[model samples]
Target: MQYRFDVQGMTCGHCERAVRQALVQVDPNAQVQIDRAQGRVDVTSDAPQDTLARAIAEEGYQVAAAA
Candidate 1:
């Protein structure tokens, strides 16, 4: 399924990379796009939404909600 999340605390390239990596860890083949300026993360993955969210949270970013 495809998911769009509004994320917080992403300030730089590293932050974007971290979120992307976290999602990849869960779905491996998942597609992740982070727009730091907009505080949004768009994901296309088969993994459960909660699992994906936890991965991002583990990376120390706050996921406000799924869009």
Candidate 2:
């Protein structure tokens, strides 16, 4: 499944990586894209969105509801 999140407080490469790492931790093969300018992250994974979102949150980033 593909999930899009409107993230808050993502400002740089590290922030993007943080979110990516989190998602990968859940679904190692998961694909992630971050739009720093728009404060959003897009993820595609077979795993559940809740699982993905929790991982992202555990990495210390805010994962907003999909817009």
Candidate 3:
């Protein structure tokens, strides 16, 4: 399944990388696409939505509502 959401507090490449790393750590093959300009993340994985959101948040970012 695919999940898309807004992620706030990503202001630089490092922030993006941190979010990406967290997502990947949960599902290594997951496809992660981040649109920093829009504060969004497009993730494709079989993982549960809550699980994915937690992973992203644990990386020090806030996961906004799904879009």
Candidate 4:
């Protein structure tokens, strides 16, 4: 499944990597794309939405479902 999230507090490459890593840890096969300027994250994975959101949150970012 594909999921979109509005994530805040990502201001650098490291922030992007952290979020990507967090998502990968939750689903190794997950694919993540982030746009820090827009505070958006697009992910393609079989993992549950809640699981993915929690992973991003654990990395110290605020995450919300994106319409």
Candidate 5:
């Protein structure tokens, strides 16, 4: 499934990598694309949305479902 989230607090490359790593840990095969300037993250994974959101949240970002 594909999920879109508004994730705040990503200011650099390291922040992007941390969010990607967090998502990958939840679903090893997950694909993550992030746009820090827009606070956006697009993910393609079989994992549930809530689980993915939690992973991002654990990485210290504020996560919300995107339209």
Candidate 6:
């Protein structure tokens, strides 16, 4: 499955990396693409959207909503 979301509080490359790492921790094989300027993240994984969102939140980002 694939998931897309708009995230807030990502200001730089480090933030992008943090989000990607947080998602990967939930599903190591998942593909995560983040665009910090756009506050977007696209993830391909079997994990549910909520699970992924929680992971991102744990990393100190706010997931505004799924897109």
What are the lDDT figures for the candidates, one per model? 0.89, 0.85, 0.91, 0.96, 0.97, 0.90
For model 5, residues 17-65, the per-residue Cα lDDT tens digits are 9999999999999999999999999999999999999999999999998
Clash pairs detected, candidate 4: none
Count clashing residue pairs per candidate: 0, 0, 0, 0, 0, 0
Model 6 over residues 7-61: C-alpha lDDT tens digits?
A: 9999988999899999899999999988888899999999988999999999998
C-alpha lDDT of residue 55 in model 1? 94
Q: What is the TM-score of each candidate against the true structure?
A: 0.93, 0.90, 0.94, 0.97, 0.97, 0.93
Model 1 regions more than 4 Å off: none
Residue pairs whose backbone atoms clash in candidate 5: none
* Candidate 2 collision pairs: none
lDDT of each residue in 1-67, candidate 3, tens digit only: 9999799999999999999999999999899999999999999998888998999899888896575
Q: Which has the better TM-score: candidate 5, or candidate 6?
A: 5
Query: Where does candidate 4 stray beyond 4 Å?
Result: none
Give the alpha carbon lDDT tens digit for every residue of 1-65 in model 1: 88989889999998998899889989999998888999999899999998998899999988966
User: What order do candidates take by lDDT, descending?
Assistant: 5, 4, 3, 6, 1, 2
lDDT of 2 at 28: 94
Deviation in Å, model 2, residue 66 alpha carbon: 0.5
lDDT of predicted model 1: 0.89
